[model samples]
Target chain A: MNLILAPVRGLGRATLAVVSAVGRGAMLSVDAGRSLRRVDQWGPHLVPQMISIGVASIPLALFIAAFTGIVLAIQASYTFVGTVPLYFVGALVGKTMILELGPALTGLALSGRVGASNASEIATMRVTEQIDALESLAYDPIAYLVVPRVIAGTLMFPVVIALAIAMGIVAGWLTSIALLDLATPQFVRGLRLFFDTYDVQFAMFKSATFGTTVTSVGAFFGYTCTGGARGVGRATTRTVVVSSMIILVLDAFWAATLL
Target chain B: MSIELKDVHKAFGEKRVLRGFTLSVERGETVSVIGGSGQGKSTLLKHVNGLLKPDAGEVWVDGQRIDQLEGEPLYETRRKVGYVFQFAALFDSMTIAENVAMGLRRIPGLSEADIADRVRTALARVDLEGVDEQYPSELSGGMRKRAGLARAIALEPAYLLYDEPTTGLDPVTLSMVDELILRMSDRLGVTSVVITHDMESAYRISDRIVMLHEGRARVAGTPDEIRDSADPVVRAFVEGRADLLEEAS
Candidate 1:
């Protein structure tokens, strides 16, 4: 009876923590929305953040997309050889990159890079009393800090996703020509044959949503951080985990609802 | 402007920090709050600027009820009251000049030239000279404290709140900080509220010293009155005798 009761209590505590976090996150979103109205104040800060989030993230996203596209092309060729035309590999790679892999994988990578950094930086500010200092100075910390990062992330995610898709398609095309013994004309034909403008639009939408989730989650955890150094570390870890999970869940939701 | 806290009650979780605590400070007065660690000294200072609102009671700043205020009204009040944190709390990413200029830029119609001039003047007032481009991390502890003071004073606030300003400083630096506090109060005509455990510094700088214990302002008087207080708790604290408190308890 004691063991059963202890597990139940633990479960209840876990549920409560999760619910509290979600509620807090909703409140933060509303606050951020209101703060966004005064863009003139925070708008200048957004460019630097965008450069940090979008430009700095490009190398890693491209690197991952390159390898992912190459692997997908190779695997598709292996699976479709003799059973179907090899040109199908191009269609497969292109479709997957635009419709799913481009946004999802880039979002996951950035969840670790940008999300973790945002959380740690903001958490450090909180622990060091910089946030309170800002408040004491009559500066709205949400407007000064959180809103800029959120706007940058929302704007840059689609750009990063687009770059990743381009890199992935190019890498996949090169891999097909080098290893799969496929003619460039046939591969290009396959890509053009199945192309739909809606897939690109869908990917753009998903990237923007994922970007918002990754940044806002990090900002929320960091802004509300307590305890000190250990708490900052926890917030960073939670930002990565929660952002990645949310990106994947969002990926599924978009695919199911839109596709 | 003057400050007042009436029957203020504050608690974090089950631990009550301030219990029906009340105090008042006249404009242009320097009051030092001294207490043992975690005795709500900092919490009380925060209440003056509406940084930390009380769970129950009213906080009046210059006859305005500030505890109930929010948004621009609250920020307007905060803009007039400058808070100096224990560790200076400067933005590490920015230079000392940028940090000092931050609050000045918030003033409407202040041009770039005006902000720069105020930053220089504020830095000079704190005896910090020509280290504008250096970051907070590059400055010594004393310099950082001075820079933090400069940042707070650049706005030319009506009230200044100091939270343990002399805690980590050496004896010389501590005296220097105390002197700076006195000079700022006199020159700027800003009301000052200092929270510290340094009894000697408190006695030297404050017009009145408030001693907090057991979640209340147990002793409130001039330095001489506090020194001669008959209350055991006040006696134990002023004399720095933990044994007396233990024995009394």
Candidate 2:
């Protein structure tokens, strides 16, 4: 009976902890929303963040997408065997890259790259008393630090994902021609066979949401972290893991609801 | 125009701090709060600036209950107080000049020219004249502290709060920081509340020294009074004697 109660209590505690975290995250987002009204204060930090969080993330995003496209095209061929039309490789690669892999993979990649950095940077400031300094100096930490990153991530994520998706398709096209017997025209035909503008819209929308989740999750954990360097390391790790999990969840949600 | 905290209580999880703490620094007065590592010295200072709200009491500044203030009103109240953190806490990325200008830039009508001028003047006041282009990382610990002071003064806050401003400094630099604090109060006519573990600096710069023990002001008086205090805790801290702490406890 004690063992049973212990496990039950553990489960309840974990549930409460998760719920508490969600509530905290929501409050942070609400605070960021309020900071929006003081645009003059937070606005100056936005462009630099876009450059840092978005523009700097491109090579990594495109690199992951390109490799994914190659593996995807090859996998489609291997899975379907010779029984299916070879052009289906193009369809598989195009659809999967545009609709699923592109944003999801890029978001995952950035969850590690952008998300971890964001958490560590802010967490370092937290431990160093810079956040307190910001507060005492009459600057809103949420507005001056967190909001710009969130806005940058949300606005530039789609742009980065869009580029990655295109890169993936091109890589897949090249892979089909060189590796598989499928010609350019055949691959193009397959790509065009089922291309829907709605697919692009869905990917963009999903990527935008992923952006917000990644940055906000990173910022939230950073703000809440304590201890010292060890705390910063924990926040960085949490940012990556939580952002990746949320990205996958959002991916599934978008696919189920939109498609 | 005084900064006051009345019966303030604060705690983190299981560790209760600042229970029933009370103190007030009149306008233009310089008070130094000294204590052991976790005796709520910093916590008490944070209350005065509205950085940490008290759980059971009130913090007042300029006739406003600052602990109850939020948003723009809180910001408005905070703008009048300048806090120099323990670690300097300068923005890591910005140059010293930009850091000094940060709070000034937030003001509505300050032109770029005026902001730049204030930055220059603030830096000069702190004796950090030629390191404007350098980052906080590039500066020595003492310089970074001065830069932090410069940043605080750039806003021309009526009240200045210093948290361990002379910590981790050599004797020369410590004396320099002590002098800087005195100069800020004299030059700007700003009331100051400084938290420090250093007894000498406190004795030199503070008109009054308050010893915080177990989350409350255990001893409050002039430096000479604090030195000659009959309280064992105060004697332990003022005389730097760990043996006297046994008697205190």
Candidate 3:
């Protein structure tokens, strides 16, 4: 009786925590949505945040996309030996990079970089009473802090994804030429044969959704943080974990619905 | 503006912080709330500006019930109140000028020139000069506190709330802060509420002192009256008698 009851209690606590987090996240989103109407306040912070969240992320995204593209080309070529046309490797690499790898990997990587940093920054503000100070001064902290970050993430995510996709394709083409012994024209021709412009649109949509999730989740955890340094650490870790999970879940949902 | 809290009760999780706590401060008055750790002194100060709503009872600022206010209404109330946090809580990323200008910029129809002039004037009022471009981290502890004071004074608020204004300050800085608090109250004619454990500083700066014990106001009177109180708890606190507190408990 004790054994069964113990596991049941644990499961119940976990479910309650997840549910509580979701409710809190929804409330924060509503508050942020209201704050979004005050563009006069948050507009100045947007460009600076974009540079921080989007421009600073380019090198990491490009580096990851390049390696991912090369690996995908090598693996696809190996698997397609004699079973299908060798040029089909280009089609596989292009589709996979644009539709899946580009947005998914970049989102996951940035969940660690951008999302964790945002959580830590806001958590520090919470612990230090800067949020209270903001409120005391008659400034809405969500408008001044969270909304700018969320807007930057949402707007710049697609730009990062586009850059990542382009880098991924270029890396794959280079790999196919040098390592896979495929001609450049053959690879380019294969890429054009079955490419759909809709795939790029689909990737952008998925990335924008991921961007919102990463930032809003980070801000929610950070704003609600209590205790002190230990709490900030927990919020940062939770931001990465939750943001990455949401990105993957959204990735699957987009693929299922759009494809 | 006058500030009042009537029968306020607040709790965090299972621990109660304030239970039936009440106090009042008239306009242009300086009241210092003194209590041991975790006695809800800071919580009481926060309620005045609608930073924390009571779990029960009422909060009134200038005859207006503020506990039910939200959004812009609450902001309007807050704009008239300046809260200085224990650690100053200045934005570390911003320079001193920017920190002081933050509240000034929020007011409607304030030109850039006006904001800059106010920032300079506020800094001068706090006796901090030639440090506009420095960050909060670069300032000494006393300078940081003065900078925080400048940030609050820049708004020219009607009421000022200080949460442990003298905490962690050296003796010189502590007295400097106490003097600043008193001077600001007189010069600006702003009602001031200060939360502190330093009984001496409280007695020095406040026109009246409220002693909180176990989440409720134990006594309220002039500093002399409180110092000469018959209540054992008040006596224990005023004289730093730990044994009396132990007996009361």
Candidate 4:
């Protein structure tokens, strides 16, 4: 009986913990939404945050997308060698990059970069009493700290994902032309064969949702973090894992509903 | 009275920190709250500035009950107050000048030039001149605390709350900080409430000293009154004797 109850109790505790976390996240979202009215406070910090969260993330996003594009093209050729036309590689690369890998992978990367940093920065501020000081000074901590990052992340994730999508396709194209004995005309024809504007639209929508999730999750974890330096470390780790998980989950949700 | 905590009660989850604690301070009065590490000395100070609201009872600032206030009302009250943290709590990303200028922006009609002047003047008051360009990380602990002070007093708030203000300072810096606290009270006439375990600094800077034990003010009076108090808990805290508290715990 004890052995059976052990797992049951553990499951109950875990469920409660997740529920608490989600409840806390909801509260933070409401606070963040209300704080949106204080654009005057958060607005001035917007450009700087965009430069930091989005602009600074370019090299890493491009690097991942380029590699992914290269791999997708190679794999498509390997799988479709004898039975199917090789030009299908271009279609595969374009569709996959724009519809799936483009937003999802870039989002995961941003979750690691932007999300982790956001959580750690806010957690450090919380632990060091800086957040309290802001409150004591009558400045809205949510407006000053969380709002700019959330807005920047929401607006810039799509931009970065768009760039990544373009880079990925370009990389795949280059790989196909250089090594796969495929001509530019054949690849472009394959890409245009199945092209639909909705794929890009879907990617844009998914990336924006991913961006909001990643940054808001980061800020929420940071704001609620306790303990001390160890807590900061935990918040950063949690931000990366949770946001990445949420991005993948959202990706599937979008694919199922929209596709 | 300008600041009053009427039977304030606060608890963090399961642990009660302040229970039925009450106190009041008139304008221009400098009060120091002293106690063991976790007796809510800092908690009490935080309530005065609306940094933390009470679980029960009332927090009155000037003429208004602030415990339940939020948004613009709370901010308006906080604008008239300054709080210096134990760790300085300066923004790591900003230079000392920027940190000091943060609160000054809300002051009406203050241009960049005027704000800069105020920053310089505040830094000068804290003897932190020429360090404006430096980040908080670049400064020593003592310097960081003073820079924090500069940030707070730059606005010249009506009330100042200092939480362990002189904790990590050297003797020289400690004395300088004590002097600055006195100057804020005497020269600027800033009503100040300080939380510290340093009894000498408390006796020197505060017109009244309140000692908290368990969850409430165990004793409150002038420094001489506290020094001569016969209550065991107050005696133990006032003398900085932890062994006396060990038996109670």
Candidate 5:
């Protein structure tokens, strides 16, 4: 009896897409280095794209973290009340926020804003043959296109995560102090004393990794998208979804290894 | 001193675009390939610069087999061949000066002033002086095409390829482009292979016209010879008869 190959075919296509996207992004990165020699041509444009993707990401990150911190504190308080003593609340919240939730959530938020935007922008450039123009001039499109994005993401993600962590901690602190009636100084001390210095290093490490993943995946998907505007839309959607999923998986793996 | 293709064959899965297609362009000769769309005209140009490789066969630039060159050698091979797209295909985000400076950046041992002088000269050659600071979006269609041409020739390539150089221009602009092609080819002594279905442009600019059919050279001759040929296919195409087009289709 012959089994239908539909599922296998679908898997193959998805795998092909992921591999192709990664390969294309890396190729562009190499090309970008070559194109960087013409930095005078690309410099002004690169400034704006980097600023738009990096600087504008700040407020949106804070907004997400504020709500997220509120929700997490409420959930943890509800789950751990009576089962554990009240003093453990700060420790639990601090560990989760600093270690996993802060960087991971920041990257997930970025996946929607910056990832989708990068993908659609690059895909449009591709469809319009702007990318081809770079090649014709012997300018590497990757170095000209993707490297700025990777650099922006690498430099920007940590800043956004740091902002998110600050905002979330404040929000969590406010909720615990006002709504849950936990002592302020005790909560602060619990968070301060929770872990060794290695945890901060580990958290920054996770943020950097997530930044690389977001930029690479987004660029790969964007540059390889075929057809036209509709294709760009599909690429943007897929980039965000794939980037978010990867963020979660990587976050889990890092937590397991680092902890 | 010329670009030559020896038995170039390229296939996409089961469909073949070019099958054993061979052609040559002598130094300082302007050759035009006139073919229906999807006849591998654009693909032929791409192969010369190593953008796309042939499935089987070889392409030689000067005396070098470009198909076998890779890395720095392949890029060096590309530095000597310039291709202009049907659309201007200017890098939209870059200023005109930056676009023109693209190829000049990689020139080894050239001083900054020398590179700047070259960029200025190349832009001036395309009649785009004083527009270096402008972006491509600020230019009109004719100007953009000229800008594209400036970028193409900025490297001072020994060979140039034009892919549908006159497809989207008005009669006036088209004539202007045709004039630019002739003037540039004459001035630089660059071997030119232009692919176009525009008969008038083909006749005006080409030293010889080649009619490509079914992925091979169907007929190649001087413009007068092509126009006055006794071959039925050539006669039908030159005359633009509906029945002939239908039959060819």
Candidate 6:
């Protein structure tokens, strides 16, 4: 018991120091007055970051969302057989697509793509003392570096998710018509029946939270990294793994409670 | 305004970096701290800017308790202190003019035109007036160091702390940096504290010298006093002992 307590006490002290350092960094960030300046500097860099996160993920988002929707429709059709009309298939798939799968999977994919990239980039900057240089120049690392990226994540992720859902629905609709021979009118009617305003609201809510969580966690870890190159890499990997896990877990919790 | 450290103590785990260290520098005094690496020269400078706190004792800046200052006041205190690192430490993302203009933009009521003028003047002071549009990576070692100096002095701080200002420069560039330090001190009336292993640059630029050893000020005196001191550590340092010289050739 004493031996365990000894290590616990040491860990507690280390945690306090880390907390203090972050608090100091946050305070200094407010004083730096260069958040706008950082955004300007980061503006050019974000093009590539955005391209990787938003543009590159497009094909994958479409592929996954569409297949999932079609598979769900086929499975529902198989189970219902003659009990429900074949037309109800689109509604079942569309509802699940927008309300559950679209936002959740898109968030998951982005957690791997955008969130990890943010962590590695910022962690590299932190390890290399570039963040320290900003602090020394009286630029707030949080306000200048972290805040803008956080805002960008909060704003940008939803747009990407929206794109994911739209593309997903289009692909699923085409698949049903081409492969299953479901009438277009039947498909549209089924989609309208299953997808409601409430589901859309809930879906958006989950995605926004997912986006904010991934970004905040990624930025926090990256900014507080210690050691050098190896440490930064470890932080980056940890961010991707941890954030992906948390997003899925949080999605489950939200779904259960909201439903 | 003066800066003073009284019985300061700092440690990282079991590795004690500062132990009962004490020193003082009066207004406009250009004191150079000369010591081997890991002797806590940079640590001592950090204490002045409130970047680090003493584990035991006090740091007084212009008669104000540095560790006690908090929030906006501490930031305001920091604004009056300028620091230059060994590598020039210019923000690579910013151009030369933007780097120099960094601190100046924070001052309220300064028009854009006035900020630009001040930036140019600061650059001129460092003899880096024309290359305002170039990035730090584009500049020569001497120019990068000077550009950092321009940024450091931009806010017209009352105190300047330079960490090995001549570390990686060639002999000609080293002297140029030395001359610039001397000229800035004389021209701006900024109290300067320089940390360096370069004994020649130390002698050329400092009015007084403090030699740190084992985390304490082993000796503090004028450059001549340092040269003439009978302290064995001082002698070894002045003679450029191979072990003490480290990487500073």
Best by DockQ: 3
Give model 1's docking category.
high
Error of 6 at B69 (Å): 2.2
lDDT by residue (A138-240, candidate 3, tens digit) is 8899999999999899999999989999999999999999999899998988798789999999999889998888888889999999989999999999999
lDDT of 3 by residue, B1-249 (tens): 389899999999898999999898998999999888878888888888887889998999977788999888888888888888888999999999999999888899999999999999989977788999999999998789888989998998999999898888889878888888888788878899999889999999999999988889899999999988998899898899999988988
Better of 3 and 6 by TM-score: 3
lDDT of each: 0.91, 0.90, 0.91, 0.92, 0.81, 0.79
Once superposed on the true structure, which residue ranges of model 1 sit more than 4 Å away at CA? none
Mind listing the fnat for each candidate? Answer: 0.76, 0.81, 0.86, 0.81, 0.35, 0.22
**Model 6 alpha-carbon miss at residue B17, Å:** 1.7
Error of 2 at A213 (Å): 0.7
- Minimum summed lDDT over a 10-residue window in model 4 chain A is located at A132-141
lDDT by residue (tens digit), candidate 2, B111-148: 99999999999888777899999999999998999899
Which candidate model has the greater lDDT, 2 or 4? 4
Question: Interface RMSD of the predictions, in order shown?
Answer: 0.7, 0.8, 0.7, 0.8, 1.7, 2.0
Tens digits of per-residue lDDT, candidate 6, B42-158, equal 889988988778899899997789878764566677778888867776777789998888877666688999989989888887777789999988998888988888888887888
Q: Write the per-residue lDDT of candidate 4 for residues B53-100, one digit (tens) a residue.
A: 899999998788888888888888888998898899999999999999
DockQ score for model 6: 0.32
Candidate 2, residue A156: Cα displacement in angstroms equals 1.1
The residue-by-residue lDDT of candidate 5 on B63-128, one tens digit each, is 788888765677677788888877777777779888777777766788888888988988887778
lDDT of 2 at B173: 73
Question: TM-scores for all candidates?
Answer: 0.98, 0.97, 0.98, 0.98, 0.87, 0.83
